[model samples]
Target chain A: MTITLNNRIETFSPQEMSITQIMDEKSFHFKMLIVKLNGTLIPRESWPLTVVRDGDRLDIIHLVSGG
Target chain B: MTIIQNITSHLSVKKAGIAGAGGLGSNVAAALVRSGVGHLVIADYDIVTKPNLNRQFFFADQEGQSKVDALRENLLHINPKADVEAHFCKITALNAGSLFGSCDVVIEAFDCADEKKWFAEWMIAHYPAKPLIMGSGIAGYGSPETLRVQRSGNLYICGDQRETNEKLVPLLAPRVIMVAMMQADLALELLLQEKPL
Candidate 1:
Protein backbone atom coordinates (compact mmCIF):
# COMPACT_ATOMS: atom_id res chain seq x y z
CA MET A 1 0.00 0.00 0.00
CA THR A 2 1.18 3.47 -0.84
CA ILE A 3 0.25 6.48 1.28
CA THR A 4 1.39 10.03 1.82
CA LEU A 5 3.92 10.45 4.64
CA ASN A 6 5.29 13.91 5.24
CA ASN A 7 4.19 14.95 1.73
CA ARG A 8 6.09 12.06 0.19
CA ILE A 9 5.02 8.73 -1.13
CA GLU A 10 5.49 5.67 1.10
CA THR A 11 4.58 2.05 0.55
CA PHE A 12 3.99 -0.64 3.14
CA SER A 13 3.58 -4.40 2.65
CA PRO A 14 0.18 -5.00 4.24
CA GLN A 15 -1.84 -2.26 2.54
CA GLU A 16 -2.32 -0.80 6.05
CA MET A 17 0.00 0.45 8.77
CA SER A 18 -0.23 1.41 12.41
CA ILE A 19 1.25 4.72 13.53
CA THR A 20 3.85 3.00 15.70
CA GLN A 21 4.82 0.62 12.89
CA ILE A 22 5.30 3.43 10.43
CA MET A 23 7.29 5.43 12.95
CA ASP A 24 9.51 2.41 13.53
CA GLU A 25 9.86 1.70 9.81
CA LYS A 26 10.85 5.28 9.09
CA SER A 27 13.13 5.56 12.14
CA PHE A 28 11.21 8.59 13.45
CA HIS A 29 12.74 8.16 16.91
CA PHE A 30 12.99 11.79 17.91
CA LYS A 31 11.56 11.90 21.45
CA MET A 32 9.35 14.97 20.87
CA LEU A 33 6.65 14.31 18.32
CA ILE A 34 3.25 15.32 17.00
CA VAL A 35 1.37 12.71 15.03
CA LYS A 36 -1.66 13.39 12.88
CA LEU A 37 -3.70 11.03 10.74
CA ASN A 38 -5.87 12.33 7.93
CA GLY A 39 -5.79 15.77 9.53
CA THR A 40 -6.86 14.58 12.98
CA LEU A 41 -4.49 14.66 15.93
CA ILE A 42 -3.58 11.21 17.15
CA PRO A 43 -2.91 11.02 20.85
CA ARG A 44 0.20 9.11 21.86
CA GLU A 45 -1.90 6.33 23.29
CA SER A 46 -3.70 5.94 19.97
CA TRP A 47 -0.55 5.45 17.91
CA PRO A 48 -0.76 1.69 18.24
CA LEU A 49 -4.49 1.48 17.60
CA THR A 50 -4.61 4.05 14.77
CA VAL A 51 -4.02 2.38 11.44
CA VAL A 52 -3.48 3.98 8.06
CA ARG A 53 -4.76 2.64 4.78
CA ASP A 54 -3.86 3.27 1.19
CA GLY A 55 -3.89 6.94 0.20
CA ASP A 56 -4.33 8.09 3.81
CA ARG A 57 -2.35 11.07 5.01
CA LEU A 58 -0.14 10.70 8.04
CA ASP A 59 2.03 13.45 9.42
CA ILE A 60 4.68 12.75 12.01
CA ILE A 61 6.14 16.04 13.18
CA HIS A 62 9.01 15.50 15.56
CA LEU A 63 11.73 17.76 16.92
CA VAL A 64 15.01 16.66 15.32
CA SER A 65 17.47 16.64 18.21
CA GLY A 66 21.23 16.98 17.86
CA GLY A 67 21.64 17.19 21.63
CA MET B 1 4.05 50.44 5.10
CA THR B 2 2.84 47.63 7.29
CA ILE B 3 5.51 46.42 9.68
CA ILE B 4 3.31 43.55 10.95
CA GLN B 5 -0.27 42.38 11.23
CA ASN B 6 -2.51 40.33 13.56
CA ILE B 7 0.09 40.13 16.33
CA THR B 8 -2.57 40.97 18.89
CA SER B 9 -2.84 37.31 19.88
CA HIS B 10 -0.49 37.59 22.82
CA LEU B 11 -3.23 37.13 25.34
CA SER B 12 -4.53 34.25 23.26
CA VAL B 13 -1.42 32.26 24.11
CA LYS B 14 -2.91 31.99 27.57
CA LYS B 15 -0.59 29.70 29.60
CA ALA B 16 2.90 28.54 28.64
CA GLY B 17 5.37 26.28 30.45
CA ILE B 18 9.14 26.43 30.74
CA ALA B 19 10.80 23.35 32.17
CA GLY B 20 14.14 24.90 33.05
CA ALA B 21 14.77 28.38 34.45
CA GLY B 22 18.23 28.97 33.01
CA GLY B 23 19.37 30.93 29.98
CA LEU B 24 16.89 29.63 27.45
CA GLY B 25 14.18 29.09 30.04
CA SER B 26 14.46 32.47 31.73
CA ASN B 27 14.69 34.45 28.52
CA VAL B 28 11.87 32.49 27.01
CA ALA B 29 9.81 33.33 30.05
CA ALA B 30 10.69 37.01 29.73
CA ALA B 31 9.81 37.11 26.05
CA LEU B 32 6.53 35.33 26.60
CA VAL B 33 5.62 37.67 29.43
CA ARG B 34 6.42 40.79 27.45
CA SER B 35 4.60 39.40 24.46
CA GLY B 36 1.50 38.89 26.66
CA VAL B 37 1.12 35.25 27.44
CA GLY B 38 -1.54 35.27 30.16
CA HIS B 39 0.15 32.77 32.47
CA LEU B 40 3.56 31.10 32.68
CA VAL B 41 4.74 28.21 34.82
CA ILE B 42 8.51 27.81 35.21
CA ALA B 43 10.53 25.10 37.04
CA ASP B 44 14.19 24.75 38.00
CA TYR B 45 16.24 23.55 40.94
CA ASP B 46 19.38 25.65 40.45
CA ILE B 47 20.12 29.11 41.81
CA VAL B 48 21.56 32.22 40.22
CA THR B 49 25.32 31.70 40.23
CA LYS B 50 28.03 34.09 39.00
CA PRO B 51 28.80 32.15 35.85
CA ASN B 52 25.12 32.07 34.91
CA LEU B 53 25.10 35.85 34.51
CA ASN B 54 26.93 35.40 31.19
CA ARG B 55 23.64 34.38 29.52
CA GLN B 56 20.85 33.77 32.03
CA PHE B 57 18.24 36.42 32.92
CA PHE B 58 19.12 36.73 36.60
CA PHE B 59 20.75 39.76 38.26
CA ALA B 60 23.91 40.21 40.36
CA ASP B 61 21.78 40.97 43.42
CA GLN B 62 19.97 37.70 42.76
CA GLU B 63 23.07 35.65 43.43
CA GLY B 64 22.33 32.75 45.79
CA GLN B 65 18.65 33.17 44.90
CA SER B 66 16.77 30.32 43.26
CA LYS B 67 16.36 30.68 39.51
CA VAL B 68 12.62 30.10 39.58
CA ASP B 69 12.13 32.87 42.12
CA ALA B 70 14.50 35.32 40.49
CA LEU B 71 13.00 34.70 37.09
CA ARG B 72 9.48 35.20 38.43
CA GLU B 73 10.53 38.54 39.91
CA ASN B 74 12.26 39.60 36.73
CA LEU B 75 9.30 38.65 34.55
CA LEU B 76 6.92 40.46 36.84
CA HIS B 77 9.17 43.49 36.70
CA ILE B 78 8.79 43.50 32.95
CA ASN B 79 5.03 43.05 33.00
CA PRO B 80 3.20 43.41 36.30
CA LYS B 81 0.21 41.84 34.56
CA ALA B 82 2.29 38.72 33.95
CA ASP B 83 1.00 35.68 35.76
CA VAL B 84 4.02 33.58 36.70
CA GLU B 85 4.41 30.35 38.60
CA ALA B 86 7.77 29.36 40.08
CA HIS B 87 8.91 25.86 41.00
CA PHE B 88 11.92 25.68 43.28
CA CYS B 89 12.92 22.09 42.53
CA LYS B 90 14.55 20.12 39.80
CA ILE B 91 12.28 19.00 36.97
CA THR B 92 12.69 15.35 36.23
CA ALA B 93 10.82 12.98 33.94
CA LEU B 94 8.67 12.10 36.97
CA ASN B 95 7.35 15.59 37.79
CA ALA B 96 7.28 17.13 34.30
CA GLY B 97 3.62 16.36 33.62
CA SER B 98 2.29 17.90 36.81
CA LEU B 99 4.41 21.03 36.47
CA PHE B 100 3.31 21.76 32.92
CA GLY B 101 0.06 19.89 32.54
CA SER B 102 -2.13 22.98 32.29
CA CYS B 103 0.17 24.82 29.93
CA ASP B 104 -1.10 25.46 26.43
CA VAL B 105 2.44 24.92 25.17
CA VAL B 106 5.59 23.51 26.77
CA ILE B 107 9.06 24.89 26.05
CA GLU B 108 11.87 22.39 26.64
CA ALA B 109 14.54 24.79 27.88
CA PHE B 110 16.86 22.63 29.94
CA ASP B 111 20.54 23.62 29.68
CA CYS B 112 21.92 20.13 30.10
CA ALA B 113 23.23 18.16 27.16
CA ASP B 114 21.88 14.87 28.41
CA GLU B 115 18.42 15.71 29.75
CA LYS B 116 16.92 17.38 26.68
CA LYS B 117 15.64 14.29 24.92
CA TRP B 118 14.44 12.54 28.05
CA PHE B 119 12.42 15.50 29.30
CA ALA B 120 10.93 16.09 25.87
CA GLU B 121 9.90 12.46 25.74
CA TRP B 122 8.28 12.57 29.14
CA MET B 123 6.25 15.72 28.40
CA ILE B 124 5.04 14.59 24.98
CA ALA B 125 4.23 11.11 26.23
CA HIS B 126 2.19 12.43 29.12
CA TYR B 127 0.52 15.28 27.24
CA PRO B 128 0.45 14.39 23.60
CA ALA B 129 -1.75 17.29 22.62
CA LYS B 130 0.37 20.03 24.15
CA PRO B 131 2.83 21.61 21.72
CA LEU B 132 6.47 21.17 22.85
CA ILE B 133 9.06 23.64 21.61
CA MET B 134 12.66 22.61 22.26
CA GLY B 135 16.09 24.21 21.97
CA SER B 136 18.65 21.78 20.64
CA GLY B 137 21.88 23.60 19.67
CA ILE B 138 21.99 26.83 21.68
CA ALA B 139 25.46 26.64 23.14
CA GLY B 140 28.37 28.92 22.10
CA TYR B 141 27.84 32.23 20.22
CA GLY B 142 29.27 32.65 16.71
CA SER B 143 26.89 31.42 14.02
CA PRO B 144 23.91 33.67 14.33
CA GLU B 145 22.67 32.93 10.84
CA THR B 146 22.23 29.25 11.55
CA LEU B 147 19.42 29.79 14.01
CA ARG B 148 16.03 28.67 12.71
CA VAL B 149 12.75 27.11 13.80
CA GLN B 150 11.46 23.80 12.43
CA ARG B 151 7.92 22.62 13.06
CA SER B 152 6.02 19.39 12.59
CA GLY B 153 2.65 18.54 13.96
CA ASN B 154 2.81 20.03 17.48
CA LEU B 155 6.58 19.94 17.95
CA TYR B 156 8.81 22.89 17.13
CA ILE B 157 12.62 22.99 17.40
CA CYS B 158 14.49 26.29 17.42
CA GLY B 159 18.24 26.91 17.30
CA ASP B 160 21.20 26.10 15.09
CA GLN B 161 20.32 22.46 15.81
CA ARG B 162 24.01 21.65 15.39
CA GLU B 163 26.16 23.34 18.02
CA THR B 164 27.37 21.48 21.10
CA ASN B 165 26.17 22.29 24.66
CA GLU B 166 27.39 24.86 27.21
CA LYS B 167 30.19 22.66 28.63
CA LEU B 168 32.16 22.63 25.39
CA VAL B 169 31.59 26.27 24.44
CA PRO B 170 30.22 28.80 26.93
CA LEU B 171 26.60 29.90 26.59
CA LEU B 172 26.85 33.45 25.29
CA ALA B 173 23.88 35.73 25.91
CA PRO B 174 23.28 36.86 22.34
CA ARG B 175 22.85 33.48 20.70
CA VAL B 176 21.03 31.95 23.64
CA ILE B 177 18.56 34.83 23.82
CA MET B 178 18.10 34.79 20.08
CA VAL B 179 17.11 31.15 20.16
CA ALA B 180 14.97 31.75 23.21
CA MET B 181 13.16 34.55 21.42
CA MET B 182 12.66 32.37 18.39
CA GLN B 183 11.15 29.67 20.60
CA ALA B 184 8.84 32.23 22.15
CA ASP B 185 7.80 33.47 18.73
CA LEU B 186 6.97 29.99 17.62
CA ALA B 187 5.05 29.47 20.84
CA LEU B 188 2.96 32.49 20.02
CA GLU B 189 2.22 31.13 16.59
CA LEU B 190 1.32 27.71 17.98
CA LEU B 191 -0.93 29.17 20.62
CA LEU B 192 -2.71 31.39 18.14
CA GLN B 193 -3.25 28.45 15.85
CA GLU B 194 -4.44 26.31 18.73
CA LYS B 195 -7.03 28.78 19.98
CA PRO B 196 -7.90 30.83 16.96
CA LEU B 197 -9.23 34.21 18.01
Candidate 2:
Protein backbone atom coordinates (compact mmCIF):
# COMPACT_ATOMS: atom_id res chain seq x y z
CA MET A 1 0.00 0.00 0.00
CA THR A 2 1.10 3.58 -0.60
CA ILE A 3 0.17 6.57 1.51
CA THR A 4 1.44 10.04 2.28
CA LEU A 5 3.35 9.98 5.59
CA ASN A 6 4.85 13.27 6.76
CA ASN A 7 4.29 14.73 3.30
CA ARG A 8 6.40 11.99 1.70
CA ILE A 9 5.27 8.96 -0.22
CA GLU A 10 5.77 5.76 1.74
CA THR A 11 4.94 2.26 0.55
CA PHE A 12 4.49 -0.74 2.79
CA SER A 13 2.97 -4.19 2.79
CA PRO A 14 -0.35 -5.55 4.06
CA GLN A 15 -2.28 -2.63 2.48
CA GLU A 16 -3.56 -1.43 5.88
CA MET A 17 -2.17 -0.87 9.38
CA SER A 18 -2.88 0.75 12.73
CA ILE A 19 -1.16 3.90 13.94
CA THR A 20 0.93 1.96 16.42
CA GLN A 21 1.99 -0.57 13.81
CA ILE A 22 2.88 2.13 11.29
CA MET A 23 4.87 4.09 13.85
CA ASP A 24 6.74 0.95 14.79
CA GLU A 25 7.52 0.27 11.17
CA LYS A 26 8.86 3.79 10.77
CA SER A 27 10.86 3.48 14.03
CA PHE A 28 9.11 6.53 15.47
CA HIS A 29 9.70 6.07 19.21
CA PHE A 30 9.20 9.67 20.20
CA LYS A 31 6.96 9.87 23.26
CA MET A 32 5.43 13.25 22.46
CA LEU A 33 3.70 12.87 19.12
CA ILE A 34 0.72 14.53 17.47
CA VAL A 35 -0.95 11.71 15.55
CA LYS A 36 -3.24 12.89 12.77
CA LEU A 37 -4.89 10.60 10.28
CA ASN A 38 -6.07 12.54 7.24
CA GLY A 39 -6.10 15.75 9.29
CA THR A 40 -8.07 14.29 12.22
CA LEU A 41 -6.27 14.09 15.54
CA ILE A 42 -5.99 10.61 17.08
CA PRO A 43 -5.53 10.13 20.79
CA ARG A 44 -2.85 7.88 22.20
CA GLU A 45 -5.28 5.21 23.41
CA SER A 46 -6.67 5.06 19.89
CA TRP A 47 -3.34 4.42 18.19
CA PRO A 48 -3.71 0.66 18.27
CA LEU A 49 -7.27 0.88 17.03
CA THR A 50 -6.98 3.60 14.37
CA VAL A 51 -6.39 2.01 11.01
CA VAL A 52 -5.20 3.65 7.79
CA ARG A 53 -5.67 2.40 4.21
CA ASP A 54 -4.05 3.04 0.90
CA GLY A 55 -3.92 6.73 -0.07
CA ASP A 56 -4.58 7.80 3.52
CA ARG A 57 -2.71 10.77 4.86
CA LEU A 58 -1.25 9.94 8.26
CA ASP A 59 0.81 12.59 9.97
CA ILE A 60 2.65 11.73 13.16
CA ILE A 61 4.40 14.89 14.33
CA HIS A 62 7.15 14.19 16.83
CA LEU A 63 7.82 16.57 19.75
CA VAL A 64 11.44 16.07 20.66
CA SER A 65 12.54 15.76 24.30
CA GLY A 66 15.64 16.99 26.17
CA GLY A 67 14.60 20.46 27.42
CA MET B 1 -12.70 42.22 15.21
CA THR B 2 -9.33 42.91 13.70
CA ILE B 3 -7.31 46.13 13.60
CA ILE B 4 -4.77 47.15 10.99
CA GLN B 5 -1.48 48.07 12.64
CA ASN B 6 2.25 47.63 12.34
CA ILE B 7 3.90 44.42 13.54
CA THR B 8 5.39 46.07 16.61
CA SER B 9 2.07 47.62 17.53
CA HIS B 10 0.39 44.29 17.06
CA LEU B 11 2.90 42.57 19.32
CA SER B 12 2.36 45.18 21.99
CA VAL B 13 -1.25 44.03 22.28
CA LYS B 14 -0.54 40.29 22.08
CA LYS B 15 0.12 37.91 24.96
CA ALA B 16 1.92 34.57 25.33
CA GLY B 17 1.85 31.88 28.02
CA ILE B 18 4.90 29.81 28.90
CA ALA B 19 4.52 26.60 30.96
CA GLY B 20 8.11 26.19 32.06
CA ALA B 21 10.84 28.60 33.25
CA GLY B 22 13.98 26.52 33.36
CA GLY B 23 15.56 26.78 29.94
CA LEU B 24 13.09 26.99 27.10
CA GLY B 25 10.56 29.01 29.04
CA SER B 26 13.16 31.39 30.39
CA ASN B 27 14.86 31.90 27.06
CA VAL B 28 11.68 31.91 25.04
CA ALA B 29 10.27 34.51 27.38
CA ALA B 30 13.34 36.64 26.90
CA ALA B 31 13.13 36.37 23.13
CA LEU B 32 9.44 37.16 23.08
CA VAL B 33 9.74 40.13 25.35
CA ARG B 34 12.64 41.47 23.34
CA SER B 35 10.63 40.95 20.20
CA GLY B 36 7.87 43.14 21.75
CA VAL B 37 5.32 40.67 23.08
CA GLY B 38 3.27 42.82 25.41
CA HIS B 39 2.42 40.32 28.10
CA LEU B 40 3.75 36.95 29.24
CA VAL B 41 2.06 34.57 31.68
CA ILE B 42 4.72 32.14 32.86
CA ALA B 43 4.05 29.23 35.25
CA ASP B 44 6.70 26.99 36.75
CA TYR B 45 7.29 25.49 40.17
CA ASP B 46 11.01 24.85 39.94
CA ILE B 47 13.75 26.90 41.56
CA VAL B 48 16.88 28.16 39.93
CA THR B 49 20.01 26.16 40.69
CA LYS B 50 23.68 26.12 39.80
CA PRO B 51 23.19 23.42 37.23
CA ASN B 52 20.40 25.40 35.61
CA LEU B 53 22.77 28.28 35.17
CA ASN B 54 24.34 26.35 32.32
CA ARG B 55 21.36 27.01 30.08
CA GLN B 56 18.63 28.94 31.87
CA PHE B 57 18.49 32.74 31.77
CA PHE B 58 18.93 33.05 35.52
CA PHE B 59 22.14 34.29 37.08
CA ALA B 60 24.44 32.62 39.61
CA ASP B 61 23.32 34.89 42.41
CA GLN B 62 19.70 34.00 41.73
CA GLU B 63 20.28 30.30 42.24
CA GLY B 64 17.92 29.93 45.18
CA GLN B 65 15.20 32.09 43.66
CA SER B 66 12.00 30.67 42.30
CA LYS B 67 12.15 30.09 38.57
CA VAL B 68 9.08 32.16 37.80
CA ASP B 69 10.13 35.08 39.96
CA ALA B 70 13.63 35.11 38.57
CA LEU B 71 12.43 34.80 35.01
CA ARG B 72 9.93 37.59 35.40
CA GLU B 73 12.61 39.91 36.65
CA ASN B 74 14.95 38.93 33.84
CA LEU B 75 12.28 39.32 31.21
CA LEU B 76 11.49 42.77 32.50
CA HIS B 77 15.14 43.66 32.21
CA ILE B 78 14.84 42.99 28.51
CA ASN B 79 11.62 44.92 28.06
CA PRO B 80 10.54 47.05 30.97
CA LYS B 81 7.15 47.76 29.47
CA ALA B 82 6.32 44.11 28.94
CA ASP B 83 3.62 42.86 31.27
CA VAL B 84 4.60 39.64 32.98
CA GLU B 85 2.39 37.37 35.08
CA ALA B 86 4.57 34.88 36.90
CA HIS B 87 3.02 31.85 38.60
CA PHE B 88 5.12 29.74 40.89
CA CYS B 89 3.26 26.51 40.28
CA LYS B 90 3.42 23.45 38.09
CA ILE B 91 1.13 23.48 35.05
CA THR B 92 -1.23 20.53 34.92
CA ALA B 93 -4.22 19.79 32.73
CA LEU B 94 -6.49 21.11 35.43
CA ASN B 95 -4.66 24.44 35.76
CA ALA B 96 -3.55 24.81 32.16
CA GLY B 97 -6.79 26.42 31.10
CA SER B 98 -6.68 28.98 33.88
CA LEU B 99 -3.05 29.70 33.11
CA PHE B 100 -3.00 29.78 29.33
CA GLY B 101 -6.62 29.87 28.29
CA SER B 102 -6.74 33.58 27.47
CA CYS B 103 -3.33 33.98 25.91
CA ASP B 104 -2.87 34.30 22.17
CA VAL B 105 -0.29 31.49 22.19
CA VAL B 106 0.99 28.88 24.66
CA ILE B 107 4.42 27.34 25.04
CA GLU B 108 5.23 23.95 26.55
CA ALA B 109 8.81 23.84 27.81
CA PHE B 110 8.67 21.17 30.45
CA ASP B 111 11.82 19.21 31.34
CA CYS B 112 10.62 15.63 31.33
CA ALA B 113 9.61 13.50 28.40
CA ASP B 114 6.63 12.07 30.21
CA GLU B 115 5.29 15.52 31.00
CA LYS B 116 5.81 16.67 27.42
CA LYS B 117 3.89 13.69 26.10
CA TRP B 118 1.02 14.15 28.50
CA PHE B 119 0.89 17.91 27.95
CA ALA B 120 0.97 17.52 24.17
CA GLU B 121 -2.11 15.32 24.26
CA TRP B 122 -3.78 17.54 26.78
CA MET B 123 -3.16 20.80 24.92
CA ILE B 124 -4.28 19.37 21.57
CA ALA B 125 -7.46 18.09 23.13
CA HIS B 126 -8.24 21.08 25.29
CA TYR B 127 -7.02 23.93 23.11
CA PRO B 128 -7.52 22.81 19.54
CA ALA B 129 -7.91 26.35 18.25
CA LYS B 130 -5.05 27.88 20.22
CA PRO B 131 -1.49 27.72 18.99
CA LEU B 132 0.57 25.57 21.35
CA ILE B 133 4.33 25.65 20.66
CA MET B 134 6.15 22.81 22.44
CA GLY B 135 9.76 21.74 22.80
CA SER B 136 10.86 18.16 22.80
CA GLY B 137 14.64 17.61 22.43
CA ILE B 138 16.94 20.48 23.45
CA ALA B 139 19.98 18.68 24.72
CA GLY B 140 23.64 18.28 23.89
CA TYR B 141 25.99 20.81 22.29
CA GLY B 142 26.53 19.31 18.87
CA SER B 143 24.30 18.73 15.84
CA PRO B 144 22.59 22.09 15.79
CA GLU B 145 21.31 21.29 12.32
CA THR B 146 19.37 18.36 13.70
CA LEU B 147 16.92 20.70 15.39
CA ARG B 148 13.73 21.47 13.50
CA VAL B 149 10.06 22.26 13.95
CA GLN B 150 7.10 20.02 13.15
CA ARG B 151 3.63 21.44 12.75
CA SER B 152 0.32 19.61 12.82
CA GLY B 153 -2.72 21.77 12.79
CA ASN B 154 -2.29 24.29 15.63
CA LEU B 155 0.37 22.36 17.49
CA TYR B 156 3.99 23.29 16.75
CA ILE B 157 6.68 20.94 18.14
CA CYS B 158 10.28 22.19 17.86
CA GLY B 159 13.58 20.43 18.45
CA ASP B 160 15.73 17.66 17.08
CA GLN B 161 12.71 15.35 17.60
CA ARG B 162 15.08 12.54 18.58
CA GLU B 163 17.27 13.46 21.53
CA THR B 164 17.02 11.46 24.70
CA ASN B 165 15.61 13.27 27.72
CA GLU B 166 17.83 16.03 29.11
CA LYS B 167 18.52 13.81 32.10
CA LEU B 168 20.27 11.41 29.76
CA VAL B 169 21.88 13.76 27.22
CA PRO B 170 22.66 16.78 29.44
CA LEU B 171 21.16 20.11 28.34
CA LEU B 172 23.51 22.84 27.16
CA ALA B 173 23.02 26.53 26.43
CA PRO B 174 23.61 26.94 22.71
CA ARG B 175 21.27 24.23 21.47
CA VAL B 176 18.77 24.86 24.20
CA ILE B 177 18.59 28.55 23.33
CA MET B 178 18.41 27.69 19.67
CA VAL B 179 15.22 25.72 20.20
CA ALA B 180 13.83 28.28 22.61
CA MET B 181 14.45 31.11 20.17
CA MET B 182 12.88 29.10 17.41
CA GLN B 183 9.83 28.49 19.54
CA ALA B 184 9.65 32.19 20.34
CA ASP B 185 9.94 33.06 16.67
CA LEU B 186 7.08 30.70 15.91
CA ALA B 187 4.98 32.41 18.55
CA LEU B 188 5.71 35.76 16.93
CA GLU B 189 4.84 34.41 13.52
CA LEU B 190 1.64 32.94 14.82
CA LEU B 191 0.70 36.14 16.60
CA LEU B 192 1.39 38.20 13.48
CA GLN B 193 -0.39 35.70 11.23
CA GLU B 194 2.84 35.06 9.33
CA LYS B 195 4.01 31.74 7.98
CA PRO B 196 5.71 29.45 10.50
CA LEU B 197 9.51 29.72 10.19
User: What TM-score goes with each of the models?
Assistant: 0.72, 0.90
* Model 2, span B1-197: residue lDDT tens: 22433666778989899988888999999988887889899999989989999988999989899999998888888878889999999888779889998999999898877788788778777887998898977778787888888777788888877756445678889999999999999998899886222
DockQ of each: 0.15, 0.64
The residue pairs in collision within model 1 are none
RMSD, every candidate, angstroms: 5.4, 3.4
- Interface RMSD of structure candidate 1 (Å): 5.0
lDDT of 2 at B99: 90
Off by over 4 Å in 2: A30-32, B1-5, B165-168, B194-197
Q: DockQ winner among the candidates?
A: 2
Q: Can you write out model 1's per-residue Cα lDDT over B59-131, one digit (the tens) per residue? A: 9999999999999999889888777989998887677768888888899888654577567556656777788
